[model samples]
Target: MMDIIDLKKKAAEIRIRLFQMIHNAKAGHTGGSLSNTDILTVLYYHTMRHNPQEPKWVERDRFIASKGHSVESLWCILADLGYFPKSELETFSQFGTRLIGHPNNKVPGIEMNTGALGHGLPISVGMALAGKRDHKDYRVFCLMGDGEQAEGSIWEAAMSASHYKLDNLVGIIDRNSLQISGNTENVMGLDPLDKKWEAFGWHVVSIDGNDIVSLMETFNSIPYTEGKPTLIIANTVKGKGVSFAENAIGWHHRVPSDEELALAIKELTEQIESLVSKEGQPHE
Candidate 1:
């Protein structure tokens, strides 16, 4: 296992890089991307079994970004992991670039081309079922947005995953409670989120999405029960690290201006320093 300090450092670095990338592109989903950063961080930097050198390595665990507009954070993490060059991110949202605003199979580490809501979980269920049939030990993880739960297809997939008894599949919902329009409850009530998944026959775990320790502990406890898929509802702030954008609906698709970017950098930089100061502290 990698040291918690080192993992945190890598996550902070990815956050900084994504912030810069979005600011430069002036066109990327900011809120969900930021909300889900720590989730991506822990998975890519710590938990996942992936080889950047061989993205197609069949033995590797598969990751699918269901809420794919938040691809900026994933792209940054993948680049840092050496799946692709860091410089490739400079082409994000450019006229001719594979690194578009959503997850694309053209990208080496991306398992599927996903921007359409509610598709990732179903595909991941299939992946898990395939692994089961082939006697592979690899797990399939899919991350979805809570607001996306309003989509009927998502529930359908949930039912399918449970019916298959996909113990190898894990679902994570970025329950930031804010979507592109407004508060998720106001838009489409999904309260008692855990019960909803539980009724679908999944083992559910709720945790603070931004807390690295919480994320690590929760992920380590996966397959919470036998013959069931796991679903983690990660409660989080929409624009997590940025003070000005946190929980604000407009930030969902807004780009940070020069001044706002500087402020966000300052805030995140302070967080980086704080984490460094806790380097020697015992991690849970």
Candidate 2:
């Protein structure tokens, strides 16, 4: 039951840790990971019911990183939660490491092998459907990239989730507006995305994805409408929080230089400090 302030501080810490991981790896998706950090922070720390010690807890809420390229933030969060040794983060992206560039089910916290884009949501629909069949109350959360919306399979899965009345299924789009090639609109044209999801029978909500408070508020009120899947269009800035990289298209998969990494860390550290200063004070 963390307050908004603690959640905000945790998100900053996650951003700092994830940056360190990507910088150490020297080969990782930087922008999307940064963009989705707050969303992950809120789900892991405040909203979702999960167990680091018991990764297979049947009653725990399930999460699928449908937009799996930006796994750096997820890896940091998993390690920080003790799903594995935090020291293993140094081995990320190395040859022969479980911590590769994508989500591998071999990892304790991961539920599926993803990163092919368009596959995660389909798989999540199955998981959600299974939960319903078993009469389980756990929720399934699928985090998708706005750029991934161009995949036809995503629409198929969206229709399936809603058709089954899987109100337990929650889909969050990290609408950062940028992908590997460039702007998503220029690439695949997914504008009016919220309306599109609603058309498929999902209850839709749009919010600033990077805002910790907004993310917390949105996630806390899941399944916004009864008997419908929930879709949150989390509008966000790619490469969020890093001053030089914010909204920069080149950072989609670009590794930061040593100087850039240092500067990013400095900025994130200052953010942590600022949040800490307001810790004991009253929150609005």
Candidate 3:
């Protein structure tokens, strides 16, 4: 298990990588990607079981970035994990690059291609069902956007997963509050989200999505209920860790300018340095 400071340092590096990748692509989802960095960091570096060298290991855990626009963060983590060469990240969104704006299963570590809202949970349900039927211990993790809950299909998949008693499945909602057009609450309210999931028979946990400790604890506690899937409502800021982008809806799909990119990188570097310093000290 990585200490909190080490985990935070990894997250900062991921953020820096995310900024550089998107900036180089000149077109990518920055807001959503930044929002979910800490969660992805925890999953990849600490909580989840995965093999970078053999991505197809049947018993290895599966993670689907259901909100595919947030692929920037996932891409960087995949690169850091050695699933693909970091050099390939520079081709994100290029005309013929496999690293298009959304996730493509053709990409080495991606389990499924997803971009359209409400698609991931259903696919995850299928994966989880297969694992259960085959008696595989591998867990299926799906990350969805808060706005996606407005989709009826999400509820349908949730119902199906509950009925099947898929204890090995875990759904994480990146509750960042903003979507492409506007605030999720204004578009379609999903308040009392935890209650809603509980009513659907899921074991629900809520946490500060940007906190490494909270993220690790929530993710590690999966399958908490005896016969139910788990839902983690991760509250997050849309443009986390970037000064001008945080909580700013305009950055959702906007690529940062060179100046903005420099600033964001500097911030991330400072964060990484701080974490490194903390890591060097003895724990209290």
Highest-scoring model, lDDT: 2
lDDT of 3 by residue, 1-284 (tens): 67788888888888898888888888889999999999999998898888889999988999989899889999999998899998998888898999998889898889988999899999999999999999899999999999989989999999999999999999999999999889988998888999999999999999899988788777767779988999999999999999899999999989888999899989989988777777758853
In order of lDDT, best first, we have: 2, 3, 1
Q: For candidate 1, write residues 19-48 as lDDT tens digits.
A: 899999989999889899999999987788
Off by over 4 Å in 2: none
Cα lDDT tens digits, model 2, 128-205, are 999999999999999999989999999999999989999999999999999888888999899889889999999999
Best by TM-score: 2
How many collisions per candidate? 0, 0, 0
Instruction: Please rank every candidate by TM-score, starting with the best.
Output: 2, 3, 1
Model 2 Cα shift for residue 150 (angstroms) = 0.5
Clashing pairs in 2: none
Candidate 3 least-lDDT 10 residues: 275-284
Q: Pick the winner on TM-score between candidates 2 and 3.
A: 2
> Model 3 TM-score?
0.97
- Candidate 3 lDDT score relative to the true structure: 0.91
